[model samples]
Target chain A: MVWLLVLIPLLLAVAAVLIPSGRLRPWLVPFGGLIQVVLVVFAISSENVSGFQGWLLLDPLGKLVLLFISVLFFICSLYVPGYLSLRAERPTRLFCACLLSMLGMMTLMTLSHHLGLMWVAMEATTLASAPLLLFNSSTRSLEATWKYLLIGSVGIALALLGSFFLAYASLYEGLESTLQFDDLIKLAPHLSKPWLHAAFVLLLVGYGTKMGLAPMHTWKPDAYGEAPGLVGALLAGGVTSCAFLAILRFYSLCVASGEAAFAREIFIFSGILSMVVAAVFMIRQRDFKRMLAYSSVEHMGILVLGIGVGGLATYGALLHLLTNGLTKGVLFLSAGNIHRAFGSKLTDDVRGAIRRVPMSGALFLAGFLAITGSPPFGPFISEFTILNGAIGSGKFVVAALFLLLLAIVFVGMGSTVLRVTQGTPSTPATATDFRESPRFVIPILLFLGMSLLLGLYIPPQLESLLKNAALFVENGV
Target chain B: MYQLIDPILVAVLLLNFAALGASQLRTVIHAIALQGVLLGVLVVVAHNEFTIWAVLMACAAITLKGIFIPRLLFHAIREVSIRREVEPIIGFIASLLLGGLGTALAVLFSNTLPIAQEHVGSLIVPAALSTTLTGFLILTTRVKAITQVVGYLVLENGIFIFGMLLVEAMPFLVEIGVLLDLFVAIFVMGIIINRISREFSTVSTRNLSSLKE
Candidate 1:
């Protein structure tokens, strides 16, 4: 079942490349995404924990990340066909192939137990997603693609170096050096502290680059702004989660070595710094897609901050992962629809999205509410829980600062969203032709509904999963 | 004789200095190739029995890094007709000085770590780190895209040397995967650079300032 989860997407990627018809190729995404989800269910239900030797295994954390990526991919896949149709030209087979290949690589990143294999998978994702970001082939997209490639490659290379440091750390413990996560955890306490510290820093920077954590997230805006919306959704939601999971694995090692406090400090600094940076940039952001990018930065900050706060915050952080992923899915898809509707992403050109494409505009508005942590929505609930966790842990100053940043982000994002969604149609040409298709709006609605449902009620099974995953982070099991 | 390779690592450090001082693309490429050759020698001399497979791989790396990539870059540069990486964001002298300071820092910092192995030489880690820093300096300071790629190659070489310290930890397949990924990434960047030159008529990243906030 585990092999099937990994192999199915790889097969689809190959098929996407081999198939000549552009129209027929995109269907491979949804088909593969569904199959992956089904396989995840089967894997979770089975009693076996160990599988695939040194290469792949479905531990609790991996299972959680896999479940998140699978569901997120499935939601974003539903939005792809409609999003592709909006392109004036026929979709290239390359786009479909790269997207599926990225899907495969992200799945592999989630499932791989070996740190080396995980790095390879992460690098493969950078290669796979670069072309997708180049879908428009505009000069700006080219620039974005270059920045994404250079920054992502450098980050992953650092990660590889970090992996080596980690392996070397094992030597100090009298253990045969290996890249397997379990082996490393068993040897964690005995490993040299200096090398472990260096390893954690490198790993944080490397994976944090992928996660679009601040200071390392210069590429997120350009890449997310220019990529097709479905691609943005997958990247912001699926790929970033996988990278966070990688960081969480290393954090687990730090905890095992009794360096949890050190790890927590770094996480807190980076996380809060990300949030503050995101808030600052989001205030003046002009492009809608760019706004979404800053939101990604802010959410990544919250995710890490949740873990950094530890205790109940870990569970809240895990819950925020689900909410953030779903909310991004809704926003990116709806933003795609609105961008298509207005024939522009510039704040100056787009107006009265509600009057034009009512379904997309309304969902975009709802997505905005949810993303900014407005009440009665999923993000609000998750964000509140994280804040409560912070307060409960006697982090009064941190909690205060977090709330301040969140409020600033909410205002910055809300104003921009309102400006785009509420006004009368400013562009006469776009308004006359604007209409919401069910294909686009339905996916947005589904994602929004799922996010809202999670807010209203946490399913007992998922709560258990989140708690178990948190335990894995708190203890090194 | 095996200890003779220790001094050659100093050549790798000097090559980075030459790269930092280089204003012309041609000189920079040559310097990078020299570093690559020095690394190939280090790899061969550092290993105990010099198996045929290891020798062949080193030869291939040397040929690719030393010859083919530089040649391809030169061809791209000539075709684009850009003469020099003129007016770097940081001046040449400052970059070289920074490169020297970076080397000093690397040496100072690396000595603090408890490294178990002695045969690998104390200089390998620092040389690799300084080269990596110099590569980053060139990458950030220079405007020309080809020079930036050369800088990236130097950085990769630095990382490669660092990885050598843990050669035991790296499986053969994983090492190959890393190399293959680097090759493909550079190839893709090369294609993009060609496109940038064709579209914008210059390989400088300054022309890419159009997308900013």
Candidate 2:
């Protein structure tokens, strides 16, 4: 059974909590992440991972999400030692435990075929990650955690109801109200039309809120902006990825029920609205960290919009998931270093980052370019494919609007990023003990390099994984 | 004849209004706690058969949602020592009217669903939905963070009511897991509320406006 994949990190987290040494507990994070990565690689390499009646199968979609989360968690794990060593005054015990448990929950979320188990796992994730926001113990962070919990819990609560409506959908057809994805897919044709539609709407709003989709994306800017950069990266990349995977499972159900067209239309509208919201906020954004938050909102928009446009766009959406995640790792980590050196998130206090921390400043700039779809980066390739898919599908207005918003965000974000990266270091910014350590710095460079490599060459293995996952989502093959 | 579950469900729905119309924090918390107890009873009363698993789940619900979590909320309010919802965004009567409108809408809406024939006339679906809507109303309308937490518990109680529709098909493990998650969520929220009250000297979300751009 693949239960081992999830249980190990959780067990290790408990161990981390029990360990007497505060200094040693933070190190447990990287160790837990490494074990998770190794186990994920092994699970993907060797088949027959299902157990407990097909509830834990590593299907192509799950495999792909598993791979991204593993990579994201592993990289973020490496930075933990560097981050915590600098902030020794603060306690790392709960932070380390929550971080590891979050990985376990995300893994459980992707792997579970049972919708009931998935909801349990998904809600568990919200509970686990809540403390990560409160790590800083500041009033703003406290407020952020408050909004995060209240809004996010309400959102996931709706998802719980959505799960019920879905199970009830099966019951309406005289089938046993089984929530296993395979069973639901097999019985999709017989599911009641009205209930199925209701299920989709609720699941979309519910998971969409978690995914930070527009109108429902209110909590994103607050939590992401207030969280420490390391936690920010995880929330943006790992937490949101789990939520997106949940949506994909439901999207697949829609495909099976032949509500694919209706789902696509809703996805398209939500996708575009998120970008417009992101773009509007991106303009005149003063805080560099908050700018990255809005950027996350935009990329999340692109992910759904890509899939909604269909065909190769689905493949692009899957690939975009990886690129966007890695690029966020680069941006948030580098931004973390800069934030420490400068002690401010706003552009006003953070002038001439290049002069202050040469390497990180350049990265924050390059990350901005790469994320905005400049050439020779993975995001650009994935984004181009989506635009091509839109054009190929004759969604010209969507394509045009997509292009326009991309430009506006690029220019909007450009001013803030450039203002941070360029110019002379303001004199008061010079005296921080914080320095760019190669330990944390190397991770960002590696992430950027990998994104660059993917833009130039799609590894055949990843390409195949994306293709199979896309096909699985679009057609229940 | 209606099953024994219907009146209990009505009591739960009325508690939704009690939570909305009541201004005192303790009273609202008590109403939600009572609703939680009703929902726990709902599981056994609504079940088609009274197996060990069903009885055990109903007990679990009562202890966690009814007794344990509400006690936590009570302590939270006691910690903050705020007795009333004090200065709601909308005053009490208007909020009650809004709650009534939502209850009406929920009743009208559940009729549109193709619920199972055996469960058609039961207040299960509409009561579940309207209670949920009332929870949202309290959450959005109330200013104090403790009241918001109470609103959240009420919301979960409503979802728990809806969860009954699938109690027979759902594994006991999932039902227990759901309750556990709800407990932890409240636990975390309670902790944060204490922190917020200490930090700002007030738990009103109005003071939370500093984080905005």
| Every model: Cα RMSD to truth | 1.9, 1.7
For residues A325-389, could you state the per-residue lDDT of candidate 2 as single tens digits?
Answer: 99999999999999999988898888899988999999999999999999999999999999999
Runs of candidate 2 exceeding 4 Å displacement: B83-85, B171-177, B180-193
True C-alpha contacts between chains kept, each model in order: 0.33, 0.65
Tens digits of per-residue lDDT for model 1 on A1-477? 567777788889889889877777778888888888888878876766555685788888887888888888887888777667666384467777787888889988988988878888898888888878878877888888888888887788778778777877876555776778888888888989998999899999989999999999999998999888888999999889989999999999999999999999999999999999999999967899999999999999999999999998998898899999999999998898888788799889888989888888889999999988987788888899899999999999889999999889989998899989998988885354546778888778889999999889989878878888889888978
- Per-residue CA lDDT of candidate 2, range B1-213, in tens? 237878898899888888888877778778877877777788787777777877887788788778887787776667776555556799899999999999999999999998887787888899889988998988888887777777777777777788777777776423744553464446435564457667876667788887777
Model 1's CAPRI class? medium
> Which candidate tops DockQ?
2
Q: Which candidate is the best by TM-score?
A: 2
Error of 1 at A158 (Å): 1.0
Q: What are the per-candidate TM-scores when only chain A is compared?
A: 0.97, 0.99
